[model samples]
Target: MSLYGEFSVPTDAFALHYTLEQIQEITIETERVVATEVGLTNYFWVSGCNLDEFETVSEKDPSIQNLRRLDEFDRATLFRAEWTEQVDAIIFAYLEIGATILEATGSHDEWHFCMRFDTHDRLDQFQDHCDDQGISFRLTKLHEITQPHTGSQFGLTEKQSEALVTAWKMDYFTTANVTLADVASELGITPQSLSERLQRGYQSLIANTIVVTPPSD
Candidate 1:
């Protein structure tokens, strides 16, 4: 008794984030044009009452979880109706899980959001769900957009892998860190050449990694 047949939510399709709760919040801000902001038409939620003590803990206290639908187009009405449908789907899924949540609260022609929480193992389960659904969900210890200098998992040349690993360990971020020139000196290569190699390594890793954010275009 349904629209198509049985609720065949493709075993492959799952949620993006592993848990309903998260600590660091990623604020993706965009400049509003004539339309100002894209609004979420509405969101639907269904709840899961089965989880035991964890549910109680989540109910009493929850963390911040956010996913902003960051997309942009010069013109407004480009993907109008379809955008609303996607937002609705997010709401429905969160509600079904007994997750503490925030339904889409803002409006922007191309922006939308939804959030929820779960912890540790529960978070892992959430990530599994995202994997099945083909959504890219990754948690980071640092909030900045980091360029990982690691090689892709499938395959990478030894030198390429080493270059990427070096990029990650450079401590290029902090004030008291050594410069690329210092590392390059140890490697017997000029800093300029080292930078080029690091760039290549970061690009390779990015091509295969699962982290997803707003469209960079």
Candidate 2:
């Protein structure tokens, strides 16, 4: 039976910690971490930072294989980067243990990983690898593949889910109620960050639940 495991690794222990310090919000999609001869190249989108600064910091990092901007939006910037072996080994350990990565996201704070494997033994192998390497991480979730992916049904991160729920309960989503700033204050995040989180969460919800069908021919 396939199983899913989720883990959190501190930014201090993650490879892209420096990049996170430069950018504000990074939303990772399913498509990530393609390994290459040089290293593992990954793609993601970020918001609330000067592109030039991101480029500069990434350029100086030896672990970064290559960094390039793919797209620009009013609020977010899309980017791709190849990472060196130093980082790739940590993530690919699951692969070595016969597991597949379903989702991976890194931020200034930490990295969140969701992976699937055929058996508990594989997961145990992964855990053993982490312990042998003395890698610091927290296994936040684990379940049989029978259960849906966390946030997969809703297209929201744990933090985003909490923020949205709090906003709704506080009447921030209702008319003549709290302002974005007020909600942000309650969440202890800046208004801009809160706005981005809400926007992304709503977009995910729409994409996942509101599928439109074409008229029958």
- Scored by CA lDDT, what does every candidate get? 0.34, 0.67
Error of 2 at 160 (Å): 14
Per-residue lDDT of model 2, residues 13-86, tens digit only: 65667667556564333333455554456666665567787777777666566677876656776677776644
Worst 10 residues of 1 by lDDT: 1-10
Using alpha carbons, what is the TM-score of model 1?
0.26
Candidate 2's C-alpha runs over 4 A off are 22-30, 88-91, 147-217
Model 2 weakest lDDT span, ten residues long: 26-35
Error of 1 at 70 (Å): 25
lDDT tens string, model 1, 1-217? 0010011122112221112232122211111111113422221111222223323432332121222333222211111111222222333334434332222212111123223333344444545765665654434221221333323231233345665556557765454577888778766777765775565455435544544442453
